[model samples]
Target: MGFLYQLGINLAALLLPVSRFFSPKMKLFVDGRKQSFAVLENQIDKNQEYIWFHVASLGEYEQGLPVMEEIKAQYPEYKLLLTFFSPSGFEIRKNNKIADITIYLPLDTKQNVKRFLDIVQPKMVFFIKYEFWPNYLYELKNRNIPTYLISGIFRKNQLFFKWYGGFYRKALQSFDHFFVQNDASAQLLKSIDFNNSTVNGDTRFDRVAQIVERAQPLDFIADFKNNTTTIVIGSSWVDDEAIYLPYLNNSENVKLIIAPHNIKEEEITRLISKIDKKTVRFTNYKTEELKNADVFIIDTIGILTQIYAYADIGYVGGAFKTGLHNILEPATYGTPVVIGPKYSKFQEAKDLVALGSCLVVHNTEELSITFNRLITDADYRNELGIKNLEFVLKNKNATKVIMDFIERNI
Candidate 1:
């Protein structure tokens, strides 16, 4: 199975140019590879010890960030090489100041992986969440470079737990240690006779905690909100918009800042057309005019984190679909969160709901009712918000735990 996987990877690399022509994202990957090696060489010298962190996309990047910052603080002598498997992560964060170098991980063919390892020669490697490339793992193990998986989660349905997934299981066993998100993941790994794991929770908790302590007031937003309650709709998808449209139309004395997942012009145009209340795109509004618009559509990227700081209530999107966006960002700000019904897979989401910090709704009507209750019932809102904030505060320091383990072992 491992051999076949490797063969497929090699085939993919060989045909990547063809794939690039068909897919927009693959084109970015091809373009990214052009400078990857140069970027690596620029930061990594033969004398310097380098640590490599690989994340699949933006969400995993956030999960791995606290640990990355810790490693930099503790081991200032070590160079950092950060790699992303997806363009969404690499493109947005390629110029991140913290990492000595940032680039897309080369295709996991034997040749590409060998070249990548040879150039950087990382002292240690960390894989965040779900990005496990078997060839990359095999090569790392062969080189005796320590590797760890941070904030990992597992399910019984994964290949590692299947009858014909011995190679996948072996690939996972290559990790020196696994700092998983919950006990379920630890137990699942142990079921397969893999025991070098710890339930350290998600490092994202630590990230969010740090965000809260350093939370700066958004003056522009504060002025816009004036004394009115504000609902922050974060990372909203089309499905989320359907449920939120009614609220936007009927609600008054409540400001709304909608930060959609895709802020392309077409999407923004469609949003403006559907909204019944006074609506303005963030890009178009001047500071003076911003105070009057009931709906502020965030037509740009990178402000979602800070926007949460101004939220009285938060509605995180992607729950309507199978995978969900980050809910902890808003929860860390001490805001009650509302989402669709598909949150069972996320341990934090389930825990938040149990702690009374979140409301789960299955459809538009339920969502409307929940929104009205959270807004009208001040005491209820404060109670839920306090619980959520406390939950975030308690779960911090995950990065410290993982870093301590890695520092000693490496």
Candidate 2:
């Protein structure tokens, strides 16, 4: 199995150039990695000790942020090297201020793994969430460097639990500890006979809770809100728009801030054409026009979290279309959230829905009814928002749990 896995890695490396022509994302996946080792060679300072964090994408980056910040605070002497396996995370946050250096993770072949570990020589390594590259884990273990899985989650049906999963299970042995999100994940690790695990909650809650405490005010958003009820639709796709756009177009005396997931010119233009109400986009809009418009379309990136602070209701997109985006961003601000029906895969969405703090709608009719109730009944909306806020507050100490463990051992 290990031999086959190595073969698979080599095969992928060979095919990456051939796959680049398939899509722009694929091109990024191929081109960005070409510079990975060189970036490490140039940026890594052998004189300074380093701590490494690896995240799959932007969501995992967020999951890793609280711990990263804590580690930097407690150990200021160590430089941080953050690596991403996906372009979505690296492309957007490559210039982030947290990491001393950020680059793409070299592919998980033996040669690439050796070069990466050789260049970085990280004092501590953390794989956020479920990234378990077999070659990388094995090599890190061989070097005797401490590796941990932060906010780890596991399910019974995974390959690691199957009968012919000895190779995969061997990869799990590399981790010094497993800071999992729930009891089920802890139990699954135990089933595999890897007992170095703890049932700490997800670190994402701590990330959002910190954002709420340190949230900065946005004047333009306040101007557009115009002292009226505002619905912030975040990361919406076309299908998600289909569920709520009609209600937004027909509704009156309310403000809608819709930030589509894809902000390409065509996507933004098509969304603007569908709305019959007065609309002002973020890139080029006057405060006067923004104050007068019914809908505010954010065609740019970043600042979504600060905008959520002003929302009475938040419609997070992706459940009906591509995948579910973050609902916790808005929920952290005490905003009642609504999303499409396909949210079962998202644990936070499930928890919020079960608590009656988040609403799930199937179609335009259901979305309309949900919006009307939320708009007309301020007290009920406030109650739901409070519940969501309370839920976030309750789950916030996960970072402390993780940091405490690291302090005792690291």
Candidate 3:
């Protein structure tokens, strides 16, 4: 199995260039080494022990960030090297201020892995969530490096439970500890006889809870909302827009802030065209003009979190599809959340729904009805909002728990 895995890795390396033209993400993979080199060169003078954190995508990055921040704060002597496996995570976070080094994880081939370890020599490594690259884990174990899987989750039907998954199970065993997100995940690991595990709640709650404490005032957003109920549509996609556009048109005295997932010119144009009312793009909104507009489209990146400060309610997108985006960003603002039906895969969404902090709609009718009721019933909205905020606040210290273990173990 190990030999075949190595062969597959070599094949992927050889074909990476060929795949680059066809996939935007493949280009990032091919360029990862160069990006890593630049980060390493910039950090040559840094005099702190390095800790590497690898995340599969933006969601995993969020899951890992609270713990990473804690490690940096508690052990100022530790330098952080954050790596991403996906472009969606890397592109947004490449210029992030928190990490000493942020780069794409070099492809997980043996040669690339050896070069990465040679260059970074991270004292401790963390694979956030379920990123269990067999070669990387095996190599780290061989070198006696401490590797941990943080905020991980496992379901009953995952590959590890299959009869042919011994190799994958062996890779899981390489982690010195597994910090799972829930009791069910811990139970799953225990059922498999995996001993080094703990149920440390999702660190994303820790991250979002911190956002609430440090909420920065957005003057433009405040002025735009201007004492009216505002519905912040975060990370919307075409699937969500198809259902939300009609309802947004009919609503009144309510401000809409649409931050589409992809802000490409074509998509932005389509979004603007769909809305019947006076619309202002976020980039072009003047202070005076923004106050008058009923709707605003956020065409830029990086303001989604701050925008939540001005939101009275939140409609988080991506739930209309198979994969859902983060709902906690808006929920942290003490705003009731509305999402589509396809939210079963997202544990937070399920939890929020169970707590009455979020509502899931199937079609435009349910969305319209829910939106109308949530807006009209101020007391009900306020109650859900308060519950949402309390939920976030309650889970704020998962990072501290995980770090306590890391300090003791590492």
lDDT of each: 0.88, 0.91, 0.85
Every model: Cα RMSD to truth: 1.5, 1.3, 1.9
The positional error of residue 157 in candidate 1, measured at the CA in angstroms, is: 0.7
Clashes of 3: 0
Q: What range of 10 consecutive residues in model 3 has the weakest lDDT sum?
A: 39-48
- On residues 1-410, what C-alpha lDDT tens digit does candidate 1 reach at each position? 87789788778877887878998888998888877878777767889888999999998999989988888988898989899988988888988987988898888888888989999889899999888898899889999899999999998899999999999988886799999999999999999998999999999999888777877777878877877899999998998888888878988778898999888889999988999988877787888887788988888877788889889999999988777899999999889999988898898999998877899988778977888888899999999998999999899889988978876776
Candidate 2 stretches greater than 4 Å from native: none
Winner by TM-score: 2
Alpha-carbon error at 57 in model 1, in Å?
0.9
Candidate that beats the other on TM-score, 1 or 3, i.e. the better one: 1
For residues 1-410, what per-residue lDDT tens digits would candidate 2 score against the true structure? 77888888999999999999999998999999999888888888889999999999999999999999999999999999999999989998999999999999989999989888988888999999899999999999999999999988888888899998899999988999999988888999898798999887788999888888898899999999989999999999989888888898789878999999899999999999999999999999987897889999999988888899999999999999857999999999899999998886667888999999999999999998999899999999999999999999888888898889889988
Ranking by lDDT: 2, 1, 3
Comparing 2 and 3 by lDDT, which wins?
Answer: 2
TM-score per prediction, in order, is 0.96, 0.97, 0.95
Model number with the top lDDT: 2
